[model samples]
Target: MKNPCIRVLATGGTIAGKAGSATRHDYRPGQIGIDDLLSEAESLGMAVTLSGVQIANIGSEDIGPAVWSPLHAATVAAVADPAVDGVIITHGTDTVEETALLLDLTLPTAKPVVMVGAMRPADAVGSDGLRNLANAVRVASDPGAAGRGVLVVMGDRVFAARDVRKVRTRGTDAFRGFPRESIGLVTPSALDWFGAPWRMGEAARFVWPDQWPEVPVLPIWAGIEPDYVTRLTGPDTRGVVVAGVGEGNMPEPVRQVLRELAVRGVAVVRASRIDEGLVDREPEDDANGFLAARALNPPKARILLQLMLASGVSVRAAMQAEFDRR
Candidate 1:
């Protein structure tokens, strides 16, 4: 390998997807090991440096701080090493976006962090994992992609980590949201675009707050119980994120609990459940409880909340300011 140290973090996802029977779409995830995946790299004609970390194999719903903590810690550590230039994470599609978003905000380094996944599991007859892996190799090895923060490479298209989202239900290109941010794209006849690289050669740049606060993102669905909110806002809670309805609307019951949380000194931010659009403030409904004027997604808003507390930024003002900085 020419580059010798492009770390490959194998937190299993569909790319490593395997099935109970080859004919079934249902997969046994976390089945493939890192070495097997790496074995394909050599065949792909890649000259990139490589390393692997097995952070988790269960469904991302099963993924939480236990898995995220070590996964994040490993990524932070990898970028600090002079021997390592970039990282490639193979994760399941379900939570890849969330993990990618989390790392986008949490990781302390700027080294390129590219995440990729497959719609079809490794066991599928025409599984897209290998090609996805190959494309990631191309992107990670590209000397131009440093300092761009984390990224997602799949279907031969590159997307910024923060902006990537999945729109398709069952296609190799199921994971959408990347090409929109593409300053350029590598097409079949135009494979030469692959050579352009995604960033400048300098390393990465990631600046985090000196302190990090613990915040919880609790969701509220119609006709749901109230215990969920109270438990999340109980003692030791620093912040609460209600995955409110459209435009930050919430069930009257849930909204009341959220207000109580705010009254108790816990920061409460309102974000919509819808994937698109800013969480609108329902003035007639009394939704001044949100921090969305700062223009943050629920998860990112929660992260900023932690960063705010860590930095001693006033909660209310921090909620508004997070949007300003973003």
Candidate 2:
């Protein structure tokens, strides 16, 4: 039997690497294109019909809106083809989470969009490209994986694009579930998720935060008193995401300032410092109108807070609910 059709979109990373003296055969992005990745795919025995499509030859860390636009367009277009069963993306681990989140919000596709990256470079002695890429191909072609939304398949865990994170800086299992926890790691680079299964809602769209006020993620760490919170506010700042302690608990002192910011219409959403659990909404009587995020870590809470602020969800309850849905 013929393998399913899976398009491997090479944005370039350790997966498409060649001997680069820059980092000393240290594996770098841009040394090859989709063709090189696809060539390796065949050698790895992934028999899926592969098309080499290159989005960028640069590191995923250095990638942003300038490159994401074209890649997003390509992903949107590729999913429309009946012959294409799925799509795999080779990305840099640094910003893979951001890209995954960007695609989750911007693209409308039921077909699985798998984002794959490697910790060690391809030219290294024990590179993980072959394994990571192979894992991505399995996810991209699985009907069960489609529309679970964009996924980051690495380190033997398949994580929802929005739920995954680079927890270990230099491990093969670089990305995985956070505080919310995952259903399971079916493959080395995949994590299971539960939601409205395998369907891309047509309602998703990108309203850039450029016009919206800036939303900064002000993390409150132990003993580093938050004098910066006072100066963190911007003229156009719409809100802030406080990366607080477990269950969104902030220092007793900082809570006062955060509440004050909320009073001035600067939305403050609380996330957890713990890997598990979420920020409980302010109690009915203690309701300072601060919203709570769904186990969103500091960075992504910023993404959600910024999106809500940008889209003008004025009520704290509504903002909280919006994040829960995401």
TM-score against truth, every candidate: 0.80, 0.84
Question: Which stretches in model 2 have alpha-carbon errors above 4 Å?
Answer: 1-3, 17-27, 179-213, 284-286
Per-residue error (Å), model 1, residue 207: 8.2
lDDT of 1 by residue, 1-326 (tens): 45647888887877776896767977777788888888877666566666787777665557766777778778888888889878888888776766776677666435667788888888787888888788777767655566555777768787666556676677887655522444334422232233343344444233445445668887767787777787666678888776766766667777677777776677777766666646644553244345662345566567656756666766565457555544
- Model 1 stretches astray by more than 4 angstroms: 1-4, 178-214, 218-228, 251-253, 280-289, 293-296, 310-313
Which model scores highest in lDDT? 2
Model 2 lDDT, full chain set: 0.73
Evaluate all candidate structures by whole-model CA lDDT and list the values in order.
Answer: 0.68, 0.73
Clashes of 1: 11
Model 1, C-alpha of 32: deviation from truth (Å): 1.1
lDDT of 2 by residue, 216-293 (tens): 777777875656787877767788887777777777677777777788888888887676656666673146767778
- Write down the worst ten-residue block by lDDT for model 2: 180-189
Top candidate by TM-score: 2
Error of 2 at 148 (Å): 0.9
